[model samples]
Target: MANTPQSKKRARQNERRFQINKARRSRIRTFLRRVEEAIASGDKSAAGDALKAAQPELMRGVSKGVFHKNTASRKISRLASRVNALG
Candidate 1:
């Protein structure tokens, strides 16, 4: 329905951005799932390693506008707390 050339270009750009963001979000979720699984398995070292790896991916999601800043912060905080509690 994009009649104007500019609108068509914008639609294309939006679609591209959507795919990229979707992939980024899925990647972030995968990293978070790894951490959750490690935590659930009660392995402190594995959980720590997973958290370390996931932290950057989550932060990257925030930086890339895939996630909100506070949302990422909250997730990191909660995961860190859970990891710390696995004493």
Candidate 2:
């Protein structure tokens, strides 16, 4: 209901943050999907390249508070291993 002015302002801010976070999450997912597709296609080089491109985006998500640091680290570690295995 946000009867208080401060509450109303907070509600607005929350909505804005929600939208921004949602977009960031979607972008990160897109990068991850690219890596997955490259890996699935059995193109080791392409998968490696995609993983390289995605690494920063994943870390950015962590830095921006969109993802946990360990979660991002784990994802990067797992993806890197898979890419290496493609050799």
- Which candidate should be chosen as best, given TM-score against the real structure? 2
Model 1 C-alpha lDDT per residue in residues 27-50, reported as the tens digit of each score: 999999999999999999999999
Q: Kindly list the per-residue Cα lDDT of model 2 for residues 1-87, writing each as its tens digit.
A: 999999999999999999999999999999999999999999999999999999999999999999999999999999999999997
| Distance from true location, Cα of 86 in model 1, Å | 0.9
Q: Could you tell me every candidate's TM-score relative to the true structure?
A: 0.97, 0.98
Tell me, by lDDT, which candidate is best: 1
RMSD of 1: 0.6
The lDDT per prediction is 0.98, 0.97
lDDT, residue 12, model 1: 100
